[model samples]
Target: MIISRESGFRHDTKRRGQSMPKRHPVNQTHNALEDEDSCAVYTALLADQGSTRSELRTKARLPLPVFTAAMEQLHRLGLVERDPSADERLLALPPATAMIRTCGDDLRYLAEKQERVYRVTASLSPYSRVYREMPSSGGITASGKRLLNRAEVGETLRDLTAGARGEILTSLPTGESEELFTLTENALRRGVRLRALYRSSVQFNQSSARDTQRLIRLGAEVRLVEDGFTEIVVIDRSAAVLPLRDDAEGALVVQDPHVVHFIVNAYSRAWAEGSAFPVRYRRQQVLEASDRTKHVIMKLLAEGAEVPTIAKRLAISPRTCQRHISEIMNRLGARNRFHAGYLVGQRGLVD
Candidate 1:
């Protein structure tokens, strides 16, 4: 069963007497029979879409007949497309759009499946004269569960994002997904406030930079934190999705109000400290904060404060404080740490 933060929508796609329903196109392409060249072609195109027929055949390593068969099947399945307007026949499809559509289809299917399961389970239980009920946590409603695979986690995120109205908050760990970019872009267009935090390291990658720029242009408040963050998605402060465990392939979806509130608060604090990464505002916050720290450190150093004490005041390391002191001395053209202080007083840089 599923719990939607929007309207308490409970849905299930699992069937007790049968295997799980086949995935929609987004996932089915990955599970196609390996012996069929269709799977190979699909995977090749997935890695690099808009490949010419020749390029695709070379990448998939399939004979002409096999390649033709694969492309035909993929096109039929809606996982690939060949534009009639373009004669060159460079096949293409936006995988992110396909994923969003598949997610929507599966969600609707699951919602119906959930109702059917409850009917079946309740009917079987009523065979006993007295209504034997499952033990429950009663009014607590602190329910939580693990999404066992990437597909489940992705579906849940799609649902929460689709339903999000007030806001969507995210901490990106690996990088931005085109799928996520599409979702957030649509969300912003729909008038939902969006904010995201990522590691400072991502600002260097060309592709990541483009994606970040696109998100910011679409009205997302994007920022970068240095450390102590994890992947999290909070929707309208009503639900949260996070990894089930560290480096796990699973996710935990929480609807508990208190837990979601705490997670949102943590995100706010991190956002406040994050450095802006745009070309016009690259790392302004970190530099400004460093200047504030340096200002205090200079005053302390001029009073003959030891490295360890200055470090304590600035919440930095003794070695780091010593390095700062060294830089200060260099700036003042002083002979040593003691001389740096004398120069500071003479220059009237500090009171």
Candidate 2:
């Protein structure tokens, strides 16, 4: 087995009977030098479009053997192209294409893929050994917080959830969580307790509402709360993830016992206050904001309030209140205020 330099995670280097070379494998592990060297080669390719072995070696300031190995690794990873008909020069893939195709839509899997690539080479470079020898910093500091930028969040968060053995809790935002659905599903399949909290608005969104309903059917306990929440992901009470702020461009990871407990407590309180995400919360379950306002007005009309009084109660202009009344009547196909009141009763919008 070869231990990953990033987090000391071990993956079997042996596959189908392959073995690590008898050389100083640690010294040959992939690290900073290879990264710098690859960048130099890529930059050169940008200029000439297709770089010869000699050209790349010169540009990267690497010897023949080192250049050869680096190019081989890059080629394997689909970062560069070598066409037989186009000679032996290296052609870099377009940046967007290379990134999306190689890393997919998320940056989480890059580390595992790199580990597999290095394992195939079977010998670590001196640069890699030096990186391994360096003391760890930033992750799990003495303060028990690990700070990561937006670029690092996906991978680190994925790693945290993947290690869950008992439970996973997530408070999702308004946006889609397509990437996390599979991860959560996997945890459930492993008999891990899965619970998720979402904004009440999500049940009104067709796509996400479907996703939550699907999750519920699959044994995930999904609930909804309305507003005043931040994104938090907790794994078995051992770790908690919080985005740095609303923008989600960075995150603060909490592994300290006190901090993790604090986050879990908040989650528990929210969970207690939330409503179950009804699989019955299908299409059009929630009315539009304006529509809900109309219903509110209907109740006021039902109670025999005049337009001026309704407008004051709702904090809208009387003209706006009259407009909403017209809209509500139009929607309910009512003849007048009395008929609209009758429709509201029929629809059961309010007691």
Q: Which tens-of-lDDT digit does each residue in 227-272 have in candidate 2?
A: 4256888899998878764445667777788988988888899999
Worst 10 residues of 2 by lDDT: 19-28
Using TM-score as the measure, which candidate wins? Answer: 2
lDDT (Cα) of model 2: 0.72
RMSD of 2: 22.1
* Model 2 steric clash pairs: 27-124, 27-125, 27-126, 28-124, 28-125, 29-124, 29-125
Q: What residue pairs clash in candidate 1, if any at all?
A: none
Tens-digit lDDT track for model 1 on 1-351? 668799998745354664345665433444345336777888887787677788889998988887887777766556676657766555556666655554665666667778988998889776542422222322122356556667877887888899998999988854568788888888999999988887654665578878888878878888866452678889999988887655477777888898888998888899898877665544875576455556667777778888876654444558767877887788889899888887887788875
Q: All candidates' lDDT scores? A: 0.72, 0.72
TM agreement with the true structure for every prediction:
0.41, 0.43
